[model samples]
Target: MQRNQIIRTRLGWTLLDGVERLVSALWPARFKGSVGRVLLLPAVLLIGILVIGLGYMIEYSFHELDLSTYRLKDEYSLVNYAVIADRPVYMRVLNRTLLAALIVSVTTVFLAFPYAYMLVRTRSALTRKFLLIALFLPFFIGQVVRAYGWLIILGKQGLINSLLEGLGLPTLNLIYNYPSVIFGLIQYMLPFAILLIVPAVAAISEDVELASEGLGANWISTFRYIVLPLARPGLIGAFVVVFTLTLTDFAMPEILGGGTTDFIASAIYDSFFQLSNAGLGAALSMILVMIGSVIVAAIFYLAGTGTLGVREQSR
Candidate 1:
């Protein structure tokens, strides 16, 4: 027993000594904040690059597209912006994208809340393992592949239709519609909402919940009064993230919209690729950035900026 204890003591000391040496070699413990900032230098550089690229796009958006040469005009004008403002098509696409994003965010949150709550509140190890697998399994599947899977399931002669035909029923027009796009988006966004919300749900103390129950508070009251408010930040975060993602999504609408239903992303792609109008695409890209920024800013403004974990308030 003594020999075993001695060996264990030596092992612990060795691990501690190794950790100390590694820390000394990597960064000074005395200047933790400075070391952290140094570690984030690469991220700062990347942000700088993004800012520079946006500046170039903003410059391009002010110029006209020369269709003959397929290049931007040397003289600056707001012709591209004017086109966007004058055309009802652009506004319609933007409005549709925004509405779809809002719907997807809300639907995902509603469906995810109960699932996330169950995942966090369950006591069974088997339940946790199963829930985790369900949560993370889709991550292995690419977004485009998931969208295509829906195609096979919801197509005119796909799985559902095949089954329906076998039963002597007519096939429904499931794909290439607004509802199909929204449904595909909801399925794609559900896992993200649950992942974002699980941490907040888990953060609630079971002891506090029990105490609330003891105080004559029913489950509904306890959740409404105690749990809902605490989970608001995470929910807001998930909503904003999902909103931005859906607003800027390209694959779902392109693959499923079936030529008629076009989101702003598809609009931009058509501008850039189909028409070979880089200037018009740049203008649309700028508008998208501005709209997305307004949404994120609105979320931060209402939620007090903690929702995104931004430390701007410390300044």
Candidate 2:
């Protein structure tokens, strides 16, 4: 009986020891995590600053204003929002903004993808270096300068028209419309998309290509199935970059859109500068903020849920 008691006691001690070890592992003896010192803290601070700015804008958007004093009036009113809601012109401008964003984004990706592919796949070192430098060259120049360069190229009687006329062909009017805005936007945003996609294309394994070849797959088939799937993150990233830039870009649309092709940004500028309507301008800015918020939220949700894998499967 004494021996039985000792064995039971030893087993109980062993069980208790294991429980203690597990508890220690799960909840450490020392709490080492500094929540304030997390890597995301700086990002949180930056986001907080932006949120505060947006909050102030939202607050300003809700009030009436006295243009003489340049101060807000008492009593919150929805008059600004009502003005936007009643105006078909505002809605048209919003639609134009979305359409231009879509066009520029799609064009940028389509053009950049092949160029980036060649940059990575080509074996020529000088060619690769030159392409990279050329891609980044526009960024070194200011946006205003680049826009002016496009103005020179696409303006009435510009180089393209001159060339066509020299060839005895009728001159085409490409500027002062949607096409000019899209052209300038693509030129401005292409670098971002190319940079985002090139790394993914470069990172593709040679062994994977070889394996696909061994399976009787041709180059096209291999690229379609094996390569695209692996590079999906980069592609998605590029699309997001292009889409967001085109959606928010003010310079291209302002300079190239002319009066008839007024977008939300141009509308906001007109309200502020021409009309001197700060409240109205704030309201328009708020509207853009809401639209941008929706887009960003949708992108985040799609990225979080991994629904962006459609890019590879569609191919």
Candidate 3:
């Protein structure tokens, strides 16, 4: 540590320090927070624009579609919300979306945890590189392409079917079902779950774990009490991400569902594009956003925001 400090002193980074001075001089001490607020203007501006768009959509959701005029009615009513409430199809689709999101989030987290643990804990550079490569290779392919790839592999007369035919055996039907849609969601979500979890696992000190073991804690006990609690933040974060993405996903379910299953996103598409019911589509979109917001709020209420790296008063 002493030697490293000496090296740091020898390389004083004079040019970078001069640039820092130049920047500091540009924003005088009297205008400190003002300059920082100016720098934040673009992001705040974009958020304001988004809030405005949401306002428009909220207005749209309350208006009725005038089919004769092929435009939204200027008069506002509770018709859209009433339709959503009275229609059982909307509830069914919403429930299916919620179920799928829940299952995909849980399954992806379960599969990702061990992978993240191994990736973070391993010391070998080559092993880490290899794992990273394997994990990211699928990302180069687009989600639609990946879903279609599953179709080709899981369809009749595909690779597995061909193998079964060669073996003079019956082939299994694989794709285009509720489970198949969930499988695709799981595949798409696994890497994201692992990426979110790695930081949490990495934050844990191996020395602390070792000390626990030294105190006569078994592997299961240590994991249940120490690792799980410490990693709850990341786990909840991954759950929220995967759940929202799956809840709003259009492509995977649309491609893999074989017309037998439909998530709420697909229903929204049908409402707007296929049926030309813009009012209903707006209502559905708002519903989707509300559902997502509620889930995130519930997660925060239960787990707090430490998973998101917010400053803790105690920490």
What are the Cα lDDT values of the candidates?
A: 0.90, 0.83, 0.89
Instruction: Write down the RMSD of all candidates, one decimal each.
Output: 3.5, 12.2, 4.9
What TM-score does structure 2 among the candidates reach? 0.79
What tens digits encode model 3's per-residue C-alpha lDDT throughout 13-81? 766788789988986778876877899999999999999999988988998988898788999998988
Off by over 4 Å in 2: 1-44, 67-70, 164-170, 303-315
lDDT of 2: 0.83
Q: Which is the winner by lDDT between candidate 2 and candidate 3? A: 3
Tens-digit per-residue lDDT, 113-164, candidate 2: 8888899888899999999899989889988888878878877888998999
TM-score of each: 0.89, 0.79, 0.88
In terms of TM-score, which candidate is stronger, 2 or 3? 3
Point out the worst 10-residue segment of candidate 2 by lDDT: 306-315
Which number leads on TM-score?
A: 1
Model 3 has an lDDT value of 0.89
Error of model 1, residue 230, in angstroms: 0.8
